[model samples]
Target: MSNSSLLKTAVLAGSLLFGTAGATVGEEADARKILGSMTEYVSSLDALSFDFEEYHEIVTTDGERLGLAASGSVALVRPDKIRVLRRTGYTDTDLAFDGQTLSLTDSDAGLFARHALPGTLDHLIDTLRDDFAKPLPAADLLTGGGHGGLTAPTAEIKDLGVGVVSGMLCDHLALRGEEADWQIWVAQGDTPYPCMFIITSRNIPLAPQYRIEVHKWQAGPVEADFAPEKPAAATEVALADYLKGARNLPPNFIVEVEK
Candidate 1:
């Protein structure tokens, strides 16, 4: 069987094994409602900042699944400005999008790239994904209308009840998509921030997963600069060249868009 066909079969097996069949209609409705509330609350924020830990699993040629881990912080202002800093054992990278330009810097490699893309945060996210093939992890939660974006491809929703993340009580939900399955934990109460997100790829052997856990979340006025500062010794390069160089970097530094 082809990989895609095998993936379909594996998805079916996963649905059965994960109890997706047992989710009741009411439970599904509740799960969707919770997700909507969380998205709405996040959209209403004028500015937000958070610290996160991320894990991405890769399946080797021999079918051994190994994980790569990174820690990062995100700071955003509504509509236009955002900054993300990520650090792994081998790389320290920074991405900043102001109103008129987007910049990416590899601090460890002494290289940087810049592109003029004038738009909102949502547009920047789309450009990064569609044009550059760099999709930020848990990006659905960062868009202006995240509810619609996330729910558009959802085939099923399951309320898995409550969980505690970073000492905060949260509502756990599972959602099945056309090609993959994902889960989220949203903090309970009015804030309703996302505490954790996990996506598993059925198309890959051993079902590699990507996970993000939010350690700190803050929403309000952020007093900081959004301008991208090029490192003094860093050489500027075309965006494509930057991406090419990324492939030579440590594991998980290269972008891998889902098929």
Candidate 2:
């Protein structure tokens, strides 16, 4: 055979053998192992709190990408109570669930709404998404099943080695779903909390991105932390009415569609 043809044949043989071996190795690359450990730690906590900085990217009709930044804090108490405070240049929003009632307040508009909801934190997370079309900030990490529910539909998970985020070493994981791509950096060592999260809407026009960077994390938050401070003069309305006003506001993460 010609020298060039022999080299091509060797390359083909090597690739076929290596491809099979690579698949075998990739099958064992279950990043879920790390995620499961983190979940166990998170679920075992009676309470938790974290501070985060978040950003959202949007593509204008002119194809220009615009980014917005916001900072927030989250507190969670297992089974029921949770609270979140988010501040942006445009608005100050707070959400609190005290095991019996769920309240939402937007200080920029001087409006507040409360709805009775008695359930676990997981149920609260689902209700906000299904009923109100609102996503609890960084909730995928706080949900009862933790990464389980969030990653159930993911088709591919890859370990992207180790990296440093917010001054802590982390195990970087990348996941690909049918519609989106996500990356998470789980802190290393005894505490495996996720220190960073990024999601890209691959199906969108510009494939816009949303990212959250965690700064502070703590466990065992007190019960009083979940209480919402309702303004005395703030207007109260039905959940639907409250959402009508909120529907125009930018969400913590980008929704599939924009109004």
Best by lDDT: 1
lDDT of candidates 1 onward, in order: 0.82, 0.79
Q: Quick one: best TM-score, which candidate?
A: 1
Q: Model 2 segments beyond 4 Å from truth?
A: 1-30, 144-149, 247-259
Candidate 1: 10-residue stretch with minimal lDDT: 144-153
Give one digit per residue, the lDDT tens place, for model 2 in 1-259.
9999999999999888774122234543557787677778877888888899999888876787888889998888777888898998778888998888989888877789989999888888888888877878788777533533445667677777789997999988777788888888999999888889888999999899988898888877554556676788678878788777763446554445556
Clashes of each: 0, 0
Question: What TM-score goes with each of the models?
Answer: 0.86, 0.82
Clashing pairs in 2: none
Candidate 2 residue-wise lDDT at 80: 88
